[model samples]
Target: GAGVSQSPRYKVAKRGQDVALRCDPISGHVSLFWYQQALGQGPEFLTYFQNEAQLDKSGLPSDRFFAERPEGSVSTLKIQRTQQEDSAVYLCASSGGHHSNQPQHFGDGTRLSIL
Candidate 1:
């Protein structure tokens, strides 16, 4: 199968607007993770899912951010009422399936800019 495919590549949004970012992990991958990465910083975990079950979301910055993996294949990260602080590269990573502790494959990510 192909490697992880992170989508949109870029986005520009005004403060207080909403945005949705999509990610496609490797085919048949059993786990997905979403993160926010600021310039010069490592990716910050926002949420995670195993199949269609959201197993952890404690890292999400605020209530305005949401993530889902419905049907267990594709994942989406949504931000409501975007803020200037939300400007960053949103990343998706996946690892697992009959295995654990495998290295996660990262995507190119969507660069989000909030004006």
Candidate 2:
């Protein structure tokens, strides 16, 4: 089974460093989302996109975080001037679509460590 793929299973960066995370969703999936999960906590939504359109981003903590799906397939999440509080697992998920009832498939996620 071809599931979502995420790059850099782990990342270590110093405070104020910038990092970019990559996500490759299942082929043909139309809905994509980014989430952040802290220790002993459930994932919290950070952003959502339907195809090439980014429909929601209110969950982003600050202007330093940015996400995009330029081609409607591969997506990237970038964080600038990373802070210690930004340390967490960044997850990427994809589903069939808004009109479809397919459950979301998630990647292994990238654990970011801010020093």
Candidate 3:
């Protein structure tokens, strides 16, 4: 019954620093995805995992961004050496499948602010 959740809801960091955001998806859901939403822009796919196996990560902008799901349940997104352009909302969603129209439930997201 637990829905997707992201921590901090907001994060502020100086350029060249690092930050980590957490996501907890609904219990029993096997599909999880991460997306980045810039101001006024649609959510862009960042990465996805199905039961601890990372199915895709082509959307990750740079090597500075990393994500992992060790136990097939919780996930973490870590951004290293943050830059001003990295400021955006980090969203997490979960669904019953890997399709684009699976009616994913979303967490509010952690809004990262790079200064």
Candidate 4:
């Protein structure tokens, strides 16, 4: 596929453990987004990146979450001190344009479970 790709299709973490999720967006994509989706709810934005710059991160639940796209390509999302409440599907998406109305391409999320 020519769209975004995410790794570790599934993850199980013990409470308090740290984990990292990876996302590889379509080549040349300029905008990237990370979202958290809980069961029975819609995906909630976690962060946004334009090229190599992190433009927004207000949606991140807490300081334990972090994301980066150092090379304006592959991105990584890290979560520390995982809690049961943190269990959710982490989604990654990318868009070819910078405009807010641009349609984003999404990757199958990494489902994380905290025990």
**Candidate that would win on TM-score:** 4
lDDT of 2 by residue, 1-115 (tens): 3999999899999999999999999998999999999999999999999999999999999999999999999999999999999999999999985685579999999999999
- Give the 10-residue window scoring lowest on summed lDDT in candidate 1: 94-103
Query: Model 3 — TM-score against the truth?
Result: 0.94
Which regions of candidate 3 fall more than 4 Å away from where they truly are? 97-101
Candidate 4's residue-wise lDDT over 1-115, tens digit each?
4878999999999999999999999998899999999999999999999999999999999999999999999999999999999999999999987778689889999999999
Least lDDT summed over 10 consecutive residues: which range in candidate 4?
96-105
Q: Give one digit per residue, the lDDT tens place, for model 1 in 22-53.
A: 99999988989898999999999999889999
In candidate 4, which residue ranges exceed 4 Å CA deviation? Answer: none
TM-score of each: 0.96, 0.96, 0.94, 0.96
Model 1 residue 45 CA deviation in Å: 0.7
What is the RMSD, in Å, between candidate 3 and the native fold over all Cα? 1.6
> In model 1, what is the error at residue 30, expressed in angstroms?
0.2
lDDT of 2: 0.95
Task: List ranges where model 1 is wrong by over 4 Å.
Answer: none
